[model samples]
Target: MGRDTSSAMVEHLDFFQSFDDVKVYYDNGQNIVKQALDRSVGKVLSKVVVRRRKTSMAGYRLEQVADYLSTIELALVKYEAKEDGETYNKFFGGIGSFKRNWLKQARCKRI
Candidate 1:
């Protein structure tokens, strides 16, 4: 049978969710910081790759990239300050809690 990555990914989401909640502790309430870090790191990596290729920034100076990343960081900070905690009120109960409540009646061990 052909591998069904989508279904497999869905099945594995619980593992990722619990790890996120317990180990990383970011996906639920602190995604904005993650987003900013991703943006800035992406730009820095692109700059490195382009330099390695011996190509110009194509009218995008290094300073411009820095400025853009800084802008994204500032925007996320503003959003974090303005956002209400209600956004994650339900999520705080967490994936483990949901699984316990919903899976208590399941008869199959794998399912």
Candidate 2:
């Protein structure tokens, strides 16, 4: 039998109360991260836009958002790469490849 029994065996994993489903967790995580980033960008822009009044700062603000998102994505990739190594291997060993798995791994690492 070639069936993967490992995943069929349930693993006890706790998550934030608001996220019942993994997809929901991922979506909420992305939204929360973006919102926080946007707030930070807004604060910086409020100060910078005063002096750069003539330039179109809308495009520049968007570029900053994109850059921050890319940075977060890179950190997640690092977590996924770590999953293949020694850290938290026991917790994530048989979970397989899901984009949100990195979130779980990162959380576990922090605790």
Candidate 3:
């Protein structure tokens, strides 16, 4: 991650601040992440704890949930862009249903 993405993460510092402690788990590239965070949010670094995990071998339940949510969000973006219509339509039952159903429910759980 570069300063740009790290800068984006800094924008969410308030979310991190809400929790007493924040733990970030990554599958790889710990060094890059650390560097990014160091440059972007170094002052609040003490509140965050970063860990490296081989998710493929031993993944946490939250990680699975995160993956699911991200996949759905990506699908929504692709649908809006009018890309991969067939697959999204088959799974989500068309754009109207996808928005009224999936996206609505997902947004309710947004943090």
Candidate 4:
């Protein structure tokens, strides 16, 4: 809240009264976060459904084996691409841009 959510807060009663814009923004941010969480949950559920289809019976076991192999292959490709400068830069850049902008200033520096 603009009401100085800070330590010396009560003094900012005027700031609380002026919170109309910030209240709207807080609601909007909560909505966005809820939507993202919903989407992620849907994705995780879908993956579980797909993986469950490869159970241990009949040809299912074979399918599971193939799926595991493909997953490992894809992981290898991603790992190798990370070692290739241009590919790694592009991939990481895309991800960095997609994450919250607030995170930019929060990045940890390594010595």
Point to the candidate with the largest TM-score: 3
Q: Which ranges in model 3 have alpha carbons more than 4 Å from their true place?
A: 1-59
By TM-score, the better pick of 1 and 2 is 2
Provide the RMSD of all predictions against the true structure, rounded to 1 decimal.
19.7, 17.8, 6.4, 20.5
Error of 1 at 36 (Å): 29
- List the candidate 4 regions with Cα displacement exceeding 4 Å: 1-59, 83-111
lDDT of 2: 0.41
TM-score per prediction, in order, is 0.22, 0.24, 0.47, 0.24
Q: What 10-residue stretch in candidate 4 is worst by lDDT?
A: 20-29
Q: How close to the true structure is residue 45 of candidate 1, measured as C-alpha lDDT?
A: 32
Candidate 1 pairs with clashing backbones: none
* Alpha carbon deviation, residue 3, candidate 1 (Å): 65
What are the runs in model 1 whose C-alpha is more than 4 Å off? 1-60, 83-111
The model with the greater lDDT, 3 or 4, is 3
Clashes of 2: 0
Listed per model in order, the count of residue pairs whose N, CA or C atoms clash below 3 Å is 0, 0, 0, 0
Candidate 4 residue-wise lDDT, 1-111, digit = tens: 222233223455466445433211112237656454444433433323322122224535545555545544454455456543456445434434413331232333212
Q: What's the lDDT for residue 22 in model 3?
A: 60
lDDT of 3 by residue, 1-111 (tens): 666855676688788678765655444557777666555554445524543334462547778678779978998899878894787888998888998998899889998
Put the candidates in TM-score order, highest first. 3, 2, 4, 1
